[model samples]
Target: MAGAQRSEGVVTVVGSIHVDFFIRVPRLPRPGETIKGHGFAIKPGGKGANQAVGCGRLGLPTFMVGRLGRDFSELLLNNFRSNRVSTDYVYVDEETNTGVAFILLSDEGENMIAFDPGADYRLAPDDVKRAESVISRSSVLLTQLEVPLETVETALSLAKEKGVTTILNPAPARELPCSLLRRADVVTPNRVEAFMLTGVEVRDVKTAVEAGRKLLSMGAGSAVITMGGEGAVVVTSEDAYFVPAVRVKPVDTTGAGDAFNAGLAFGLAQGLPLVEAARLGCVIAALKVTKFGAQEGLPWREELEEYLRKGVLELTTPTRV
Candidate 1:
């Protein structure tokens, strides 16, 4: 595994880690219905890990801070190593099993997921405190809500105290307090999660802009509401714009949001303006959905650069709202 380095542009991820079990079916089964699946595979996953890998693959120095079960500790750690993510702050819980997600992926690339948050729930505020140095020295701190809420709060608070850029990916939608939201420099939430946080149904660019403004009013420095194929809406106190998604035939939409978050964080850490960072995120997400598996689909730095060099897909500038 890569050793945690105290670098100027390090991106530290404070979140959950999990092992995912996938079942490929023609369609998702209805409640209490039994169906035969065509394929099965196990892979390393979790919002935190997915984003961390995405950042690392983009050639950023990334560190992961979270918990794993003793049962899957080596499996996940090895994955971090292979992906070039530093595992210095990853903890292993002996009492609980590793977190797991059972996903049913349809031929249309839609997915339904059920999660067992085993050791992930055990990641406490104290663990965040122990990784405080990592967050303090980071150029960007990326986090998600899969771990305990208080833990996420602590990480954000510490990062804010150090003036580190913080990106919060609010997944598995839940309402959050303003105090926590205020600490985030950038908040990237999908349409559903945005609607949950702001009560503004984000069905189109206009509605997404409404939701983004609601997030800003709630205290986030900026809001990026991802609308999947329709692209994303970016809003700050001064500006609101829409970035279009790259056209692609999606094979699996899993982890596309994580990929977006990683690209956004990477762009921000490199000192790009907010809107440009969001444009980068859209490209990364569009690339991710064209392949299967969350981590497997993430594009490496060379691939992203080459994709841009080709100029086959023109990412339009953010349109003013």
Candidate 2:
């Protein structure tokens, strides 16, 4: 199915959009310490936008449902258009400023980031209310925590009402109500986020299963704990298994998660099983970390299929986490 024509369902991304300012340094600065940067660059990013880009680049029909400031609307819309992501539901708030992220990247590929959500947080329930039809018709509804929790909850609730598959990538970890978790068909959280949600440290496969169990107990139908280089573990009532990360020389780890989530949604849209979808996600993420920019590194459908056909052969095997 990798090279098949896209006559599948649409993926709707309801999340954040930001202009990322990246400063490269020899290493992260200490408190009250100033360091010279090797170089600097700016790019378009945000969990939601990156995921939408990922979906589009993978040859999936995708839509972005979020808020943007008037100042950055053109830039963001152009990005969506280039990626083939429909921007029909993107709201523009004239009174608010565009969102931005200040990132400090070390030469070793480690990163520290801070965000000013600005208009991203201004996405109200009313905004989502206007896109109810879009949400209802979607095959997969993907979202993150960059937007207001209320907005996320509203989107999740609507997806549930429509019986759409809901995937929640709980990033920038925060405590959430069980009502929200229960509605999610799948919750994909990185190590830090897993710890924040389940109070379980996810250092290896065993602990990842434990954390996943906690998430299931909290009401998520399934849980995926992404452990970066350690690989990812998926836990559900039917089965538990690990999907190894595709190893590559790392350049930048930014946007890896976004790419992974999009890959997951794309796989599901193609009617792949849950664990297989996540394996496809791992394939996309491995490609993402080998490049510098977030969206720039996302693979087109042909590129991804070629790589999947040639490399990462062992993804067919799933070991118990």
Off by over 4 Å in 2: 1-7, 313-316
Clashes of each: 0, 0
Candidate 2 per-residue lDDT, tens place, 1-321, comes to 222222356888999998888999898899899999967998999999999999999988898988888777898889999999999989889998888999898888878899999889998878888888777777888999999999999999988888788999998799888889998999999999999999999888999999999999999989988888656899998889999888788788889889889889999887888898988888898889889878888999998988978857475357865
Best by TM-score: 1
The per-prediction CA RMSD against the true structure, in angstroms, equals: 2.9, 3.0
Q: After TM-score superposition, what is the CA distance of residue 207 in candidate 2 from its true location, in Å?
A: 0.5
TM-score quality measure for candidate 1? 0.96
lDDT (Cα, tens digit) per residue for candidate 1, span 1-321: 022343566899999899999999999899999999977999999999999999999999999999999798999999999999999999999999999999999999999999999999999999989888777778899999999999999999988888888899999899999999999999999988998999999889999999999999999999999998888999999999999988889999999999999999889888888899899999999889998888998999999999999773466467999
